[model samples]
Target chain A: MRTARKPLTAAGLLWGVVILTAVLACSILAGLSTGGGEGGLRELLFPAAGDGDGTRQILLQVRLPRVLLAALIGGALTVAGAVFQALLRNPLADPFVLGVSGGASIGSVLAVLAGIGGTGAGMAFGLDGRMLFAFLGALGALILIEKIATVDGSMSVYTLLLTGAIFNAFSGALIYFLQSIASLEQLHDIVFSLMGHVPSTGFGTVAVLAIGILAAVLYLFLQARDYNAMTLGEEGATQLGVDVERVKRRTFVLGSLLTGLAVSVAGLVGFIGLVVPHMLRLVLGPDHRMLIPCSFLGGASFLVLADLLARTVILPGELPVGVITALVGGPFFLYLLRTRRTGHEFR
Target chain B: MRPALILLAILSAACSNNLQEQKPDPVSPKDGLRLVVVSPSAAEMLAELGMLERIVGIGDFVSRPPGLNRLPRVGPYNAPNIEKVLDLRADILVTVRSEAARASNARLRDLGVEVLELDTSHWEGTRQALRTLGDRLDLGESAGEILASLDEAMTTIRQRAEGSPSPKVLFVVGRDPLYVAGPGSHIDAMIQTAGGTNIAADSDSPYQLVSLETMLQRLPEVIIDTSDNGPDALRGRLPGPWDTWDFLPAVRENRVFWIDPDLLVIPGIRLPAMTERMGRLIHPEIFGDPVEADFEPSPEPGPTETTIEDSP
Candidate 1:
């Protein structure tokens, strides 16, 4: 409805992408420039006269990978949230609203309970058992929710939403049961994993997560026009020569893939998914074509900066990035809701 | 710290089994005046004072002083069941100082129970706690003897550690989020007395969740990791996870140790023994190499008679 009301021009879309990309670049620069340690962009720009391996290691080995991971997770979660909102035709829809994050959390909690964490439990290409199990949990939850929601040969939006809500509640209860039995040290790991902090990972893991998230985002981007058409209603989309059911199924799968990749690596970094898409939609309108790409870049910038604040706000001790995101995003979103004109396009 | 609070809430909530039991009429104290010791460290102190038979109930986390096993568990240390404590007819309830359980302890006191909140988290607090508990229980002579032995043992340890190099040490309490022992903690005091500079001495709190990058930058020479609690978690002088950070001096020199947290975390009469163990781990040349038992999870306190004199 928003796209139909306001025509999106090619030039306007280009300008939006360029501006968001510039913002993302700035955010990444800031993220790479500062950290909890001495190694930073200064070391990279002007090498000391003496040995600088430690500084380089801090920059490259610690901060660089963390920045990249945050960017990727942010982008993936935002894109997934935007797509889910379009498919569900609900402004409140988020990547985690469909129980995928809860599934990832259960897997993560179970892994910690079994003592399968730390950088030492390396399984493949810097992927530990915890991350692997989280991804599998997300995938399993997707399959289970899909099966429960599908009726005959079709999936109903209302049924899908309800199934996801119930599944998430169940997952939460199960995780609590698991936590009850966990040792104090294991309990610490479980709580941190759920609270969501971007860990300093190897480049191999970042590269792998990047490829997976980008491919899913690309697939969803291909269906942007279909999403725009569906905003009119499912029947209207079908009347406009769109394969409504096929597009819906594909969007569900691709969006869920993005959410899974993010939750598996970074735990449950909240608010970015729920807040960024709406913020971008208010600025760029609900044209999925522009909204998808801009949301990715804007969300990437948002989280990179939030993570920077999370690490630096208390000097040597770092807060969970999720805390920063929720603290900033929740109030901003509430303010936007309170001040914005009623029945706005994004709302 | 926030996570620890969440964990405390979870543990408190999980101790719901006792809540389901019938709340029988609150029984008045019997002639014997039984004691319910909710703090594991305090229970260990009571056992050391030869008052093990006096404890009628224990908090959930208390595992030491095996004689108390038959006693009914009230609940976790932070959220003991008041009904259960009353049912056991405990005239005196001894618990550790906790901000979270302040209201519960207050309510217990209102209900006519003599609640003794002890601070056994540091050496001085433990000494004071022994004195207070001894005065209350009329075992002041035994408490004095225990304190004397502890001071004598600690003085010997400090004398042995006088000239030894103070290697930079990292006392890891939890690994995934990198929780460390910082200033004001018993572990921090032990690290200092045993001739090692705590890497987290500059941290703002006693126990802090710190950045891994900052920890690496500090370059600790000796790492005492009591973080892993898995049944098959690494033990002894081995770099299980620290090996990944090959650049760390502790990893390079093979000085990364995986120990049981219970051995050093609980502060009580074992401060001297725990400090001696720390001395062995920190300066083996003078104190002798840590024996196999040093790395194991000995939640049970050693024999009371020889606790001060025993050495690896």
Candidate 2:
């Protein structure tokens, strides 16, 4: 039993970190390799060769920023997913599992209908309407779900999850209603926003996104010990000097914030939140301290690679990043479920 | 050049070998040449040729001279009702070109209904459509006359634009998700003809979603909102969120204008008129004051002008 547990310990966590860093680096190189192949990824590494051509502009301006945004969003979502699973103690817990995606979708659809398809619906005080509205929608969903789920000043994880599920269903129906009334142009925007993509952003936007995601993720990381105690059950966590209720509220809000930012920038990319943390937990033990950062790196790598596949698989016309996530993650998730049930692994 | 010659060679050989499927109908002057046009601009084109009297069935989006509303709507531009068309005893049908949307054109053709699907979606297509419809309907001489008059108007508009201050313009096509008439679009051509540069002319598509950041950065001098919900609905929704971007010159100067899609959206032989109107909208000083032309642009009334409040 002791030998069997070796990989799920500190040593394994260290190796996992190293492995994830490598994967992220490789994924960035691999992503950069696909588009604007004037001199390839190596030339990009060498500034001299990568400059003075359209390929250079395409690589640095378009491809690099896209990959960076994908990585940031993916990492943020994975960290949030890890925290949520630890909080809810549900195997199926993901960012969207709590109505975050539904709220963002509503906001995005509203933007489409208002004639701000690819652009921000409006801008006020430097906050874009599309991003601001989506974040507000996410926060709104959180409040509504929490209000419905909480009873006697105590929150039930099951009720919280259920309320989220119902809200998401309600949002889906409402989106269908909106789509039914929309013009063909608006309808196209609605479909694409809901379908979700890792859209290209300016370097300035990418920098802001990366910094914001990093802040949120680092905040989540501060609560890793609490999340670790969380895996021992809420009572167990409380017994270990953790403020269980405060931790829950903070993590829920923080996780939803991460989800909102991700969705606003990249649309509804799925699976990274659900699958990345679980995979990390299996290899690095249920230690949130290690799992959180690993999840970020692994998730970043996973999304960068997935986004790479999305753009290249179809060539000029690309599949939505969400489609790629669902396609690649769906079967792997099923396999995890099937094997975990059969093999009794990583409880 | 070589490909054209080969195409010509193939066409001559094919035509000489009697491989043509299209046959003219046996409608005499007494029958008045029954026609069913499944597009608004096509209906407008026929109206330009003085053939509006022959149109028996119109499409859903064909809003004009208040009488066509009484004529049976075949369907949306693409999926027209063949049953109703046959019931109306229409000898020929004209529609737009979008591959899958109008795929039923093949079935309509197979059913012995002469389906003339034209690329009447852009300026070039509109020009060609005029000549083709004229030749097809034996009104080629009339088509020539209309083309000449339109050309004259275009030349005047071009000369008006020449050396004039061409302000940066943004043409909004849809609002909810911020789509614009980009490069290769009829709207783009109109903007170019009207002494304004389309800021979105660099986009790869004819119509595409543009980022608001790009718009603010581009800082358009004039913004034209062409998104038509309905006449009444649009009037209520006229001052859309465009004012929020007060940093934009268009918003700062209140140069933003809402032209009904009826006058602008439908690309056809009305290119000259549409281009001139766009000129007036974008470069009022260069093109002179804007004339509120006949809003009900139909040459002849169909029967009832039911405003198409389409949802489904």
How far residue B259's Cα lies from its native spot in candidate 1, in Å, is 1.4
* Stretches > 4 Å off in candidate 2: A1-12, A49-52, A111-127, A146-165, A179-192, A336-346, B1-41, B49-312
Return the top candidate by DockQ.
Answer: 1
RMSD of each: 5.8, 10.2
User: What lDDT, from 0 to 1, does candidate 1 have?
Assistant: 0.77
Cα DockQ of the candidate 1 complex: 0.32
Q: Give TM per candidate.
A: 0.85, 0.61
DockQ of each candidate's interface versus the true one?
0.32, 0.06
Off by over 4 Å in 1: A1-15, A45-53, A96-100, A111-122, A132-174, A183-185, A336-347, B1-31, B298-301, B304-312
Separately for all candidates shown, the number of backbone clashes (residues 3 or more apart, or on different chains) is 0, 22
Which candidate gets the maximum TM-score versus the true structure?
1
Candidate 1 lDDT for residue B304: 46
DockQ of structure 2: 0.06
